[model samples]
Target: MEKSIIIGLDIGTTSVKAVAFSRGGRVIGEQEIAYPLSTPFPGWAEQDPLEIEAATITVIRNLIQLPTIDEKNILAIGLSTAMHSLICMAENGEPLSPSITWADGRASLQANRLRVEHNHIYDLTGTPIHPMSPLVKLIWMKENNYLPYQQASYFVSIKEFILYRWFGCQSVDYAVASATGLLDLHHLKWNKEALELAGVSEAQLFKPVSPTEVLVDLDKTIADQIGLPVHIPFVIGSSDGPLANIGLGAINPGEVAITIGTSGAIRQIVTEPKSDSLQQTFCYGITESLSLIGGPTNNGGIVLQWLKETLDIKETYEELISVAEKAEPGAEGLLFLPYLNGERAPIWNANVRASLFGLSLRHKKEHIVRAGLEGVIYSVFHVGQALERLAGKPTTLLASGGFGRSPLWLQITADVFNQEVQVPISHQSSAWGAAWMALFAIGEVTDLASIKQAIPMQENYMPNPDHHKIYMDLFKLYQELSHTTHSIYMK
Candidate 1:
C-alpha cells in the first residue's frame, strides 16, 4: 500500500510555515519562509498580499522538495491562518490595498464611535469593539477615505485571499468569519446591520463555509508547480487560536488552553452558543457541536522577544526562562505592561503602549525579565477569570506553543493563575490538531475522544500555595497599576 501525506499550512505574523505529516502522522517535512510586516506609520501595520502569496508558494514548493516524503501521495492540504486580517481586492482577484493586520490600531476612533453610538454591535458580532478588529478598520477606511474601498470589488481576510488564489473560489470559513467582528455569531453569517451602518452590503462579500469540510480543489497550475497532485482536495480551517485549542486537546466545554506564540491567547471550548455579558471576548465555532468562548490577548511571546532584543540578551528562550526563574517572585517591584503592539481581551485597549512601572535603580535585567513573564501570565489569568465569570466556573489550562517550551514559565503561570496546567508530551498541536480534524472529516477517527488515547502526557505543574498568596497581593497591585496607567498610555 502506498503511504499518504497531509500538509498543514500556517500563515502567521512573521512568516508562512508548512508541515507535512505521513499517514502514520509522523512529521516528514517542515519549512518556514519569513516575510516582513510593513509599518509605514507609527500605529499602522500592513502587508502586500502578493508578497505573502508568493512566500506561501515558495515555502510549499520547498517543503515538497524534501527527499523524505513522496509528493504525489499527499492526500489533503489544510490551511490554518492568523485571524482578523482585512484585505481588499478587485473583481479579478487583484489586491486593491495592503492587508491590515489585527494589530493595527488606526481605527480607534471608529471603534469608539461604534461603541458609543450603536450599543448592540457586540450582541451581533460577539467580538468587542477594538481598533485591531477588521470591522472597525473597514469603518475607518470607508468613512475617512472611501475611494479605495469604493473601488474594491471584495473585502476579505488573509485566508480567503489565499483560497481565491489557490482555488479561484471567493469564500471563507464560518470560523474565520466568526472572528471578523462583522459576522453575527448566532446567525453564522455577515451582520447586515453593521453593513448598513458601515455603508457596505452583503453582496460585496464572499461566502462563509464550514472549517472542516472540503470546499474546492487546488488549481492544476498551482498544484503542479508545488509538486502536489493536480485537483487534490483542500479544506478551509478554523483560526489559529481555535485550532490551537483542538491541537492541544482542549476540545470540550471548560477545557481551556493558553497559547503563547508570536501572539498570546486564552481559549476554551463551549458546547452551547454563549456570549459574554460583559463583552470581554469573542466566541468562535470549533465544530457544529462545540463552540469556543474565549478571549485573545495581543500580548504574550512577542513581549519576551522584544525584551530579549532590547536588553541585548542573545540567549535562547530556555536561558531567558532560567534568568527569569532566578529573579525573586513578582520581580520584586517592577511591573512590565506588555503592550508593544497593543492589547486585546479583558482590556481591549489599543491606545496603550508598553511600560514598566516600579522600575528602580535596584532592579536589573533579571527582574524585568521575570516581571515580563509574570506580566504575560497575569494577563492570561485575566482572560481565564473573564471566561470563568461567563462560563460560571473555572476551566483546566492546557498550554501549547513557544511558551510550552519553557518549564519555568509554565510553573510561573500555574502559580500565578493558581491552577494546575497540563503540558502535552507531543509538540506541534497546531499541525496535529489539523491532522485530527482532517482524519475526522474523512471518517478515519470514529469519535473525537478516541484520539485522546494517542495524546501523551508530559508534565502537570501545580500552583505553589506559598507563592500564590504572595502573588495575590501583587496581583491586586498589578490590577491597580493597570487601571491607573490606562489614561497615560498614549503619552
Candidate 2:
C-alpha cells in the first residue's frame, strides 16, 4: 500500500525549510536552504525577494526528488512564514524594493512619532507601533520619498509576492495581515484609517483570507520548474508564531507557546482580539474567532552566535554549550541583558544596548557564555510576565525552536519562568502546524482540535523551586538596571 504525505514549507528568517510528513505525523523527508540578510545601513535589514523565492523553489524541488517521497501520494502543500515583511512591487509583479524584514529599524524615528501621536492605533489593529510594522515602514517611505513607495502599484509581504508568482493573485492569510498594523482586528479587513495614515489605499493591499484557504491550478511554467503538479492544492497557512502554537497543541486558553530561534516569542491563543493596555504585547488575528496575544524578543540563540563569532571560539556549538554548562547558575553574580539586537516587548524600545552587569575579575569566558544564555532566557521570562498580565498566568508551555534542543536552555527557561515546559518530539512545530492545517483544509483531518492527539510530545521540565527563587531576585535587578539606563540609550 502507498502511504500519503503532506508538505509544509516554512519561510523562516534565516532559512527556508520544506518538510514532508506522513499521516502519523512522522517526518519522512526534509530539506533546508539558507539565504542571506543584507544590512545596507546600520539598523536596516533587507533581503532580496527573488533570492528567497528561489530558495523556496529549491527546497520544494529537492523534497520532491527525495527517494522517500512519492509525488503521487503527496496530499497538499501548506505555507508557514515569518511575519512583518514588507515588499513593494510594480503592477507587472516585479519587485521595486528589497524586502524589508521585521528586524529592520529604519523607521525608528517614524515609529516613535506614531507611538505618541496615534496611541489608539494599537487598540484598533492590535499591533504595536514599531519600526518592524509595515505601517511604520510605509510612513517612512512616504516621508523619505523612497522611489519604490512612489512607483509601486501595490504593497505586500513576501508571502503574498510568492503567492502572486504561483497563483497570479495577491492573497494574504489573516495571521500575516494582522501583523502588518494595517488590518482591523474587529472587522477582519483592511483599515481605511490606517491606509490613510500610511498614505496608501486598500487597492495596494492584498486580499485577506483565512489560513486554510486553498488555491489550485499552479502556474504551469513555475510548476514545471519546481516539479509540482499543475493541479496540486496549496493551502495558505498562517504566520509561524500562531502555526507553531497549533503544531504544539497550544491553541487553547492558558496554553502558551514559546519559540526561540533567530528570535524569541511567548504567545497564547485567545477567543477574541485583545492587546495590552500599555501596548506591550501584539494581538494578531488567527481566525475570525481566534487571536494570538504575545510579546516578541529580538534576542534569542542569535546572541550566542554573535558571541561565538566575536570571541573567535573555535569549538563546535555543542562544545560551546558545554563550556557554558561549566559555569554555575547566575554566572557567579554576572548578569547579562540580551539586547544585542535592540529589543521588543515589556519596553518596546529598540535603542537600548546590551549590558553585562556585576561583572568582576572572577568572571571568565565560561561565565560570559553562561550569562549570555541566562540573559536570553531571562528576556523571554520578562516577556512572558507581560503576557501573564493580559492573558492570566499560562498553565502550560509548549516549547519549540533551536533553543529547545538544548536541555540546559530548556531547563533554564522552565526555571526562569517558574513553570513546567514541554517540548514536542518534532522540532519543526511551525511546519507541522502548517501541515496539520493543510490536512484540515483537505478534509483529511476532521478538525483542528484533533491535531493534539496526532502530535507526539517529549519529556517535560519542571521548574526547581530553589532555582526559581534565585531567578526571581535576579530578574528584579535586571528590571531595575533596564529602567535606570533607558534614558541613556534613547536615540
CA lDDT scores, all candidates in order: 0.79, 0.91
Per-residue alpha-carbon lDDT of model 1 for 1-491, expressed as tens digits? 55478777788877888888754456788888988998999889889888999899899899888897677777777778887898888878888889889878889888878888986888777778888778888889888875768798888888888888778887777777877777877868888888777667787778777777775567878777776776666767777877777777787666888888877888887776688778887787556666788787788888888888999998997788788877888888788777777778877888877788899998988999999998898888777778888775556788888888888888888898888999876456676666666666665667655555655668799999888987787888877777666656634
Clashes of 1: 0
Candidate 1 TM-score over all chains jointly:
0.95
Over 4 Å off, model 1: 22-26, 487-491
Query: Which one wins on lDDT?
Result: 2
- What count of clashes does model 2 give? 0
State the lDDT of candidate 2 residue by residue for 331-364, as single tens digits.
8888998888888887888778899999999999
Q: Candidate 1: global Cα-lDDT?
A: 0.79
lDDT of 1 at 105: 81
- The candidate 1 region of ten consecutive residues with least summed lDDT is 447-456
Instruction: State TM-scores per candidate.
Output: 0.95, 0.98
